[model samples]
Target: MTVSVATSSRDMIEGALARAVQFPRLRYMGSKYKLLPHLARAFADVDGATALDAFAGSGVVSYLLKAQGYQVTSNDFLNFPSAITRATVVNQTVKLTAAEVDTICGEPADDRDFIRRTFDGLYFTAADREFLDSAWSHIDLLKGHKQAIAISALVLAAARKQPRGVFTFTDLRYDDGRRDLHLPLRDHFRERVEDYNRVVFNSGQTCQTRSGDVFDLPAKSYDLVYLDPPYAPPRDDNDYIKRYHFLEGLSVYWRGQKLMENTKTKKLEKKYTPFSYKRTIVDALSRTFEQFKDSTIVLSYSSNAIPDAGTIKDLLGAVKSDIEVREIDHKYSFGTHSTAQRRDVSEYIFIAR
Candidate 1:
């Protein structure tokens, strides 16, 4: 079925698009970047002044909601994505200055060699690893959102430098001769800083961010809550931490994170989340739905994921009587299969009130 956009909401969406131009879009897996138009249409008629992006993976949805005039709260279990949301969504006026960027990219004050030692030959080159070491030292010196902005840029730069923008495998085997893969990590960091800075604007609403389990979120009322949980695909390839451990480590500079030294990639010990596993996903979904039952719910899922569309609808039906499902044809940019094997799938948006 077609979802119509309210005229006022359409105007807000146009404003959102204009603001989004400067946002340094990530080639992040499962990002809603491509489906934003569909999401905007789904959100257009939803009655909400306050919204929660519960699984704010790339923070784009929270930014969209912000542009549409919602006081948004973006949350993610991963620190790296949380840093991105902090830089763009929660942060209102803070922008990294030219001096700050130079300081971040400049030589380190002390010899800190964590990335250099632990990840010597894993994801980035020796020079890039050394640059990351220096950048991490300076990034920690900045306070609050400025630090977050720097971390966000660093994470983006690292991802851009990597082939397919994932840390699942080492070496340049998947290199596609993209310009981003050739640029120095430092250059990528500087460019990303500018791009992120340009996207920073006052949404005229006090937005915030949360970094923790979805269940840990305080029982609070919002006009709406948007959920885009990690889809439990038939295969076990939706392990975001397994794919993004390096970026996650970069976000926190590996502090308090246990590195699985025996692994070839030197990834961090996997963080626990009920949503990523088949055994716990149904209970997780039920809990999430019931926890925010007072708010209008907008859930994003994939046809390739577990608990299929009909099952999800029934789950939501138990909580709210009125429900609508909208589907958009989509193809993911990155997958574990060949291009020919990567089939088109329906991205489903379940709206309930």
Candidate 2:
């Protein structure tokens, strides 16, 4: 039975991707949304009834796999990305109603600007801070995947408003005269919610999301296990948790949570992960490959990142036969300003089956 890919669901995905906002227009440090077409082509012949997106950042890769009729198990360490996974991958057709959006924005039971009080003068404007404080507080009004969708929309709104799409530093300083900061952030939140709602369609699969360390979860046989771990920086710790801590706070609704001070950001303590350490990259990659050795593995990495493509292929080759390395000229999320540096970097996709 040849099922046509030209159905209404396919058209919705095509239209959303073609739009200016892009599908799931999420702002993350190392998202592979733009590289999905290449990834799809790379895994074209590898038939799989199920796929496990081991490091499912932004849930775009998992959503793409679900769109292609694969039962996807999207996993992320962060609660924010897990919310995105729930909304997009797990919940196939549920979307927020206008009334629900109204409640989420208008009445959140926040008497004080919780965001302002906690992150005073750090990230957003005073008004924007109040909006977030109220919005996230009321996110619990809805239940199940709808709440996750709303909270994920809030994460998107916060990231879009933040300069550079990272929460490492306060972008909305009084002197930093950026135009994006001047807009009404609440409006952006509503717009993002509606956009996400519009893009929702049934992928017709019992897709799901798992939140926590990939190793902590029980290993299951998957046709293809996609891994796109946080890139190991050359020096210093650059974990995703540190970069997007604000989203983490929002996802969990930072209330009564003990926050330790981080010297780098001076906002909140950064969660430590071994995968982001230069000394542990080889060992971490080796363990990950061994854990998923029973399944076909596809790893996404950057040419400029630590361990390089040669080292990664060597690691995977030990556990799986038929290792293949492919590269596409790519630009970094932060290193796009200098033409020379941008031209030099390449995105590497390593396939081991």
Winner by TM-score = 1
lDDT of 1 at 256: 82
Q: Model 2 segments beyond 4 Å from truth? A: 1-21, 110-112, 171-179, 235-237, 255-258, 261-266, 333-343
> In model 1, which regions exceed 4 Å deviation?
1-9, 337-340
Evaluate model 1: give its TM-score: 0.95
- Write one digit per residue (lDDT tens) for candidate 1, span 243-341: 889999989998888989999998889888887788889889999999999989999989988889998998998899999999889885336535425
Error of 2 at 282 (Å): 0.5
Clashing pairs in 2: none
Every candidate's CA RMSD = 3.3, 3.8
* Candidate 2 lDDT, 204-291, residue by residue in tens: 7788898889888785798888899988855444567666777777887775444655443544565566788888878999999999
lDDT of candidate 2?
Answer: 0.75
TM-scores vs. true structure, each candidate? 0.95, 0.88
